[model samples]
Target chain A: MYLVADINVEICAAKSCKLCTQYCPEANTILYSDEMGKDQGFKYGSAYVAVDRCKGCAQCVWVCDNMAKNNAIKMIMIDQLPKAALTDNITYGEKSTTAVLASPVVG
Target chain B: MSLDYVKFSNGFEKFMPKEYRDMVEHGPFGKKVSVSQVGSFKEVLEEHPMCAGCAMTLFIRLAMVAFPNPEDTITVGTAGCGRLAISQAAIPFVYGNYGDQNGVASGLSRGLRLRFGDKPKDVVVMAGDGGTADIGFQQVLHSWFRKERFTTIMLDNEVYGNTGGQESGMTNRGAVLKMAPLGKKFEKMDMVQMAKVAGCAYVATVVPNNPRRVESVIKKAVLIAREVGSTYIQAYTSCNIEYAIPTDKVMEDAKAVENDRYQFTEYVSEEAKQYLTERYGYKEFLAKPAAAIPNKA
Candidate 1:
């Protein structure tokens, strides 16, 4: 059984800082996107974790909290995550799932 | 005539480095490729249930990249932390008895050779230190003694991770584990030297921090096995949860140990080294002191 870990990109200071990737022992487990905040002036990349591959090691959470000082990544119970985030047909090598939480975005 | 260029879809791109992105586009990352690229080939092992940040997971991924042919390769697994990848791995995998990993691989090697003499498939074993060094030591030794043509990759996490982090033969002295509450009394088992004494044609020890180096060594080990004989690649991984080491500092500790205690060594028989140099122009093989990873704790 795997736990669900999501990344909050809205408040995330996505600047291509690959602390999670650097710290993640699994390859391609945490992917980054630079296009999200390009218009907002910062060039840091938005990070997303591969839920299927995530073993709930929480290294991403550790890096985000301790190293980056941004509590952008949260580890949630698999059942608590939205039904849409969990998919049976996880096409390997495709980063299809976006780990947005169920809580309403506060704008 | 002017051509109309359509915009790509929203989900087409993920967070990937430019170098990796370019390679994935051609055929490796899921596209149809006539040939598989070591760096970008679709991972056969997917969603293993091992602990997140488990070093074995990373080692499997790196080894996959170094694999000569994922399509034709047959992966053999034994009991331990390495078993996590068996079900999810893309290639055809066989789960052997804990103490019979080498025996299974040896039989598979011979069976493949009998069926297709010149085109025998590659057989690779993913085993933990406990399975490789302690329980299955005799079978592994006999396989190397007889020169079985298979690659055995040992993911040495120092302790028996699956069985609640008990001290294994590979556990170093002075480290306190559940089995060794008062700290281990014996020094770590030298599997590298054991492989050499057992007549392994190719051998190397590496860590997960250096992906490129891991890829290079695994690729070399696989090549040597196919052309020469049996090869053993032992990778020093860490059991973060079991070892009481923080998850974030796992790689740091692995690097520190490699730099401070054990110097990473690569061994190749004289004949194989000559063959590699002559055929592949491979001259960059050396054993040197590695820089230590900073210890935060």
Candidate 2:
């Protein structure tokens, strides 16, 4: 689940900024909603992004309008089974690399 | 008055003259006073392409000021002179791109790895709205997919040209592009969101005009990119020339347009203005914010 500051857990204020909103290819993320949760009233609404749909491209955050300090939507792998590799050094580009956030130990 | 004299007096007052002698005539409290930062209006535009009015300058304002030793160290190109633009004369070693920014960027990314061997150097590929949205998009993607160490910056100017002034994919819906037959109604593609879904991490969107957050955001973006891996920096870039606007007028317009359109009201509620003052700095208001914003969520 995403950790949002107020009631509207996923909406970014820059949704109105037009920087990232106008350019986003998938119109999936709903940053604003009416059933306003806690402090996240009408001003802030969020969309539930489909994990399968996410390309891991970082566009929703890129297309944000408000320049919010905190990230509203974050991706996390839920329900992982045991027996995954403990140490996986995935090199994305040619030079840089990042360790997987979590990996299970393999026998 | 010769340009030389104007510059000489101005230079002397700042560097050598005493406070009383250096102080130029201050206009009456309410009257408008224009102080030219560059030699002339046109020259300023030509020289400082990145500094001109647009949505992205807000971010540029933050990035350019705080990015120390970019020249001689961090080598960047395009984004219509962004880091590369501001540093042309002031900071040296920034490469210039004629076209094919992405292809060139890929080569640079590859070459840096070979040369530095993961030692770490800032390799910035600055792309303007047209350049990235149209021309450089392919190369940038390849680099991103490969997970290059270089940071690719997109300045969303929203219109095509080095000529013609056609609308690119990044233009806002219904905003008038000079070449648009029906005034550009199609929605813009979300590059930042796309970048995130593409697997790019360390994503962040910033408006340089806010001054409050732009600098911190810029530093954070760059630092994050350096640490986590390749970062795709997309920011709002303003276009005053195509819109046929004055500088200060465009700055004011940027503040209003961006402020009005602000959605996601939950995260940034207290009027971006107040947030800017408290967190970033007052000078951010000195110019317009960036045009493109990255989705970090």
Model 2 C-alpha lDDT per residue in residues B1-297, reported as the tens digit of each score: 111222335455656432122112211111221211100010111123343334453444335443422321354565453443445322223454544665665676567667767554455666677766666677666666776656667776667644556778887788776688587768887777666666565455544344435445545445444435556666655666676655435444555655755211111112333434454463543447767787879
Q: Per-candidate DockQ versus the true complex?
A: 0.23, 0.01
Off by over 4 Å in 1: A1-23, A26-28, A32-47, A51-53, A60-107, B1-41, B278-297
lDDT of 2 at B248: 36
Distance from true location, Cα of B57 in model 2, Å: 5.6
Q: Cα miss at B247, model 1 (Å)? A: 1.6
Q: How accurate locally, in lDDT, is each candidate? A: 0.69, 0.44
The C-alpha stretches of model 2 lying farther than 4 A from their native spots are A1-107, B1-61, B68-72, B79-99, B161-164, B260-297
Of the true interface contacts, each candidate retains a share of 0.27, 0.00
Task: Report the lDDT tens digits of candidate 1 across residue range B144-166.
Answer: 99999899989899998898878
lDDT of 1 by residue, A1-107 (tens): 34656777665645445556545656446654444344456655355555555667776776678667878888777656553122222222333222332322122
